[model samples]
Target: MKNNRLYAQFSTGYRAPQTTELFRLQAGQTIAELDAENINSIELGLRGQVESLFYDVTLFSMHKDNFIFQDTNRQNISNGETSHRGIELAINYQWQYFYVAANGTFAKHRYDTNLTLSRINIQDNEIDTAPEHIGSVQLGLRSDLGEFVELEWVHQGNCYINPENSSEYSGHNLLNLRTGIRLSERLDIGIRVSNLTDEDYAERDDFGFGSYRYFVGEPRTVYATVQYQY
Candidate 1:
């Protein structure tokens, strides 16, 4: 227990209706007449160090009332209840000239009560656009001369695209590389390459108006930067 710490937290949140949520017209309705959202959350965490390796892990749960969401008709409405629960982890290790760091999250966002979104019954359905798994890991090498190189991999899990849970977006994984070195105390140069594999994927996906839409992700690209500090 000497090298570890445990902690817990409780929090509450409130959010008033946004301008669009309050005034946006839907079908024959003129005003939203929406109520504010209330949220309650609890979290527990543990962090510690084992020699040169460090780790932190956390678990969290949250409940919301009057949760607002846009329905199939593009009208904002409030639901009776929603719940979110998740776990997060982060770890890092460094030895001499090499180091590795990683972090990840797994969560579920769901409707807690039966609700109707434009004639569709949604109960215990995952929230649209809310991915259940997301994570990134990085490996790097560095020297005393300020030279370093890092490679990272990022991942996203699939999720529903509609409140009805009838459609989903199959997630994506990406690779990125970065390298840099100090030319002098005040001068530095670096280069970065994103989407290294040029994998075809969508950064975002949605379903609306009886159609599926995608925002395409960028292709493999390289860029450089030079920095001078006064």
Candidate 2:
């Protein structure tokens, strides 16, 4: 089409502190009435198609003020400022009944103002709970018999667990499979297997109260679902 296009956008935004941030009660903790966070963002994006292949990509940047974060003491606090940027890409190709698709994001979140946690200056450090990379890929077949099957791979990059960047949670890769069939004009059924390799990984980790802890990810599991339309 002659109208295929690329675009760029700029915007400013802000977020008021959430209820949890304003009123979470716990022993040894004090809640503060916090200011809303603000940000200025810019984005560039493209969408186009060539033959049987289609793709989209976006690049974006954000300058944030009063970024809400949890400190080493597990208290919700506003950080001075931060710079966030990322690239996101997605592509899909199809030839007849067979197709493949992938999408991913690579990002960076860094402190723009110096922070003192545990008596350490953490200016320009990677923020906790921020993964540098995350993505997924899939291959699948679609048939006229009202059925489809797909295999997928998912990934997450490592990230720090503390504002000081002293603790880490390693990255992980996982495999999954899904298949579905139409049982009738009004019914469908499906089956899924997640973490096909039964890989061991930590979903999250943190240091609190002078101790380090983690939540383990789920192991290999299978499940089924049925859907009926009225």
For lDDT, the strongest prediction is 1
Candidate 1, lDDT over the whole model: 0.91
Which regions of candidate 2 fall more than 4 Å away from where they truly are? 1-3, 23-33, 70-79
Distance from true location, Cα of 5 in model 1, Å: 0.6
User: Candidate 2's residue-wise lDDT over 82-182, tens digit each?
Assistant: 99899999999999999999999999999888755556888889988789999999999999976999999999999988878988787899999999999
lDDT of each: 0.91, 0.87
Model 1, residue pairs in steric clash: none
